[model samples]
Target: MNRKFWSIGLLAAVMLISAGCGQKPGAAPDNTPEQVTPAPGGQTGQGNEDPTSGAGGASTGNEVTKPETKTESIKSYYTDPDVMELVEGTANISYKEDQDKYEAAYQTLQKSDNPDMIPLWEKIEMKSLKFDNGTITIDVHVPDEANLGAGGEAFAIDAIKKTFFQFDEVKSIQLLVDGQQAESLMGHVDLEYPMTR
Candidate 1:
């Protein structure tokens, strides 16, 4: 939509940062296959080339695969590097005592040359951020008369999720508008009031 509207999304991003106090981030993308493919016929491909075994194997449906072991990784709420640049470079933002590392990181991030990020970065209104055990929360505010736009809410959440997921400390995120959950920030996406990462 317009700058004023997108500003809201930027503010939300800042609020997310504020919530987090001093944590690293989250884990990496899930790589362990969540779904397994079954063979054509009733057979196994564990160690043989039996035709009856099909290609891979048969569905025993007896074993239960466990989730991947937890690894030391960072989680982020923001994905767009450009958006992160806005959050990092906005001189309006203030930090808690321990959030300095993230601030520094943002400083470097501001110098990132990813061109795709330019537009999104310019439209946001970054505020303050905090990092706790892992979750990073930023506090933000949009001009009362802004017009965020369709899908603005989703865009905002996706940005945060992508950004914080980069670290390992963050696990979840929450969004607040002027301090409360509301309907779509614009008209396309749902904030779901207090979104989680």
Candidate 2:
């Protein structure tokens, strides 16, 4: 009624000067402005990471994992080809014993002490020895007055070709002095040729 108290004191002084120019209570509060959550890859932890990756700025904490490959097996037991074919078929040639090599080559040509070859090998006699292929025929038994000269028949053919070529499959010798084939058994070592040493 006094113009309605001067229009309610000019609308309460324009709402106290628009609430004193807005906010004030330890301020920065403008209704909706606290959403500043953008520091990953939008990258702002201030510098030095993507200069083509020295990998130090972006990862906020735990992730390093890696280990898995395995494989291994090459095998042995002395090259087991079924135990090397049973030690190469029991080390070849197994004659199950008893071959004192032609009775030690007829007791080394009957103990030769050469008394003109002791009555020509006291009636020389071996008769059948046989080895073949790698040679060893022997069959001696020569009689007819056991002739012995030319160094007692080259010491009974170099003591039966050095005692059956000391066997390893007898590599040579063939003298058949009595069963034939003779060009010299007392003139110079050559029982129809086959000695090989």
Candidate 3:
């Protein structure tokens, strides 16, 4: 029994020495250590957290607010495959608070769900959109590869106008190519600036 107790005391002294060696110079020799926790990224850290703060870290007031998102019904227009006229298609758009609603609606116009409908806007990329009072100005980038004729050009413009005019706030629309007003969108029909609803 005496040899067993001496052996246990030696083991306990070695453990105490090992634990004390790891502690900081001025740190108090704690009989009962405060619960040490695993920090973020699976890192083990000393339990030196402020009692006033929330469990994980700082207070909830410092937490970043998430951006609100909403899903809305969007009305988009496509060109008829046969007549090349405007065909309305309704879709649901989900967007964050800071995102542009008009851009979402405009993107929906680039795709058609109906088999008979054609997506004319797919030929051109919308660079940007600006609104003034009630007028919507659209800037587009038309690649040289797009071989759109006069009829296609007219129907494309018609689709854009029809799609935007669905909104009550839009009174008129002006089209721009590469941020400049051109005599024609594709050297076809004359572009009527600020086409009114």
Once superposed on the true structure, which residue ranges of model 3 sit more than 4 Å away at CA? 1-67, 97-99
TM-score, model 3 to reference: 0.61
Ranking of all candidate structures by their TM-score, best first: 3, 1, 2
TM-score of each: 0.39, 0.20, 0.61
lDDT of 2 by residue, 124-177 (tens): 677766665787676676665666655566655655565556555766777776
Per-prediction tally of clashes: 61, 0, 0
Worst 10 residues of 3 by lDDT: 41-50
Number of backbone clashes in candidate 2: 0
Compose the digit string of candidate 1's lDDT tens values, residues 1-197: 69988899999988888766434333323463544434455433243344443334554454445334332222222224333332322222233334665543333322334444333323334466667766666554555344434434455556555555554666765544555454644456766433455
Best by TM-score: 3
RMSD of each: 31.2, 35.2, 12.0
Cα error of candidate 3 at position 110, Å: 1.1
> How would the candidate models be sorted by lDDT, starting from the highest?
3, 2, 1
Model 3 C-alpha lDDT versus the unseen true structure? 0.76
